[model samples]
Target: MAWKVLIVDDEPGIREVLKDYIEMNFEHTKIETAENADTALKKVTEDQYHIILLDIVMPGLDAFEFLRRVKDLNSLIQVIMITGNSTMERVLESIEAGADDYLLKPFSTKEIEEILKCSFARIERWRNAFRNSF
Candidate 1:
């Protein structure tokens, strides 16, 4: 199945690495990117993304707030918070706030693929539940 994935980060390098790895590994998956939360939010509002890979520290909105807003907007949107600073507090906060998973930055390609597998599995479960609700 073709899925839509959004990568939201302030650093261009991080975004490029993620985009390249994802495109290389997943065929038929469409990847889009946003440099900051503002642009990401705009993209989220305009389009429906199956998965969102978000950065923690950003200019306009922090990952915590962004996750809250996006979850409220659509609970079906699966968000994975990625950051270099993986403090225990922030990890707990992201999970508590409804992030599907938290990934530490500088992740290996294998790690990225593993996270993608897990995220996609969760998304499938959520989608099944949503369909059952009807």
Candidate 2:
């Protein structure tokens, strides 16, 4: 099965770029986009996703707040914070709030692809461990 990704960004261009890039390069993955945190939250609640590419700053309920809420809703969901503002504080906060990884804005498509690959590998390892425990 293809891994699913949810992308939350206020900018339509960014969302489109990510969606197109992922679709073009990654045959084993699919991506969905939401323009805001609220909509993203609703979608996440309705469907399971392998990874979430979330922007740090939005019109309302910024990525940090969304990350916290997502963790509260589903601990297994892996969130990868994406931001133009790459501050140490934001990175640390994202980690504290349970983001699995953080990517800076204007990052190369190759970087994003690498991160997704690592995320999938990590999830596979986790699944294996969980199955073994049963």
Best by TM-score: 2
lDDT of 1 by residue, 10-31 (tens): 9999999999999999987899
State every prediction's TM-score relative to the real structure: 0.93, 0.95
Clashes of each: 0, 0
Q: Per-residue lDDT for 61 in model 2?
A: 72
Q: Give one digit per residue, the lDDT tens place, for model 2 in 1-134.
A: 78899999999999999999999988878889999998999998899998899998998777788899898987777899999988898889989989999889889988998998898888899889999999
Which sections of candidate 2 miss by over 4 Å?
none
The local distance difference test score of each candidate is: 0.91, 0.90
| Candidate 1 wrong stretches, greater than 4 Å | none
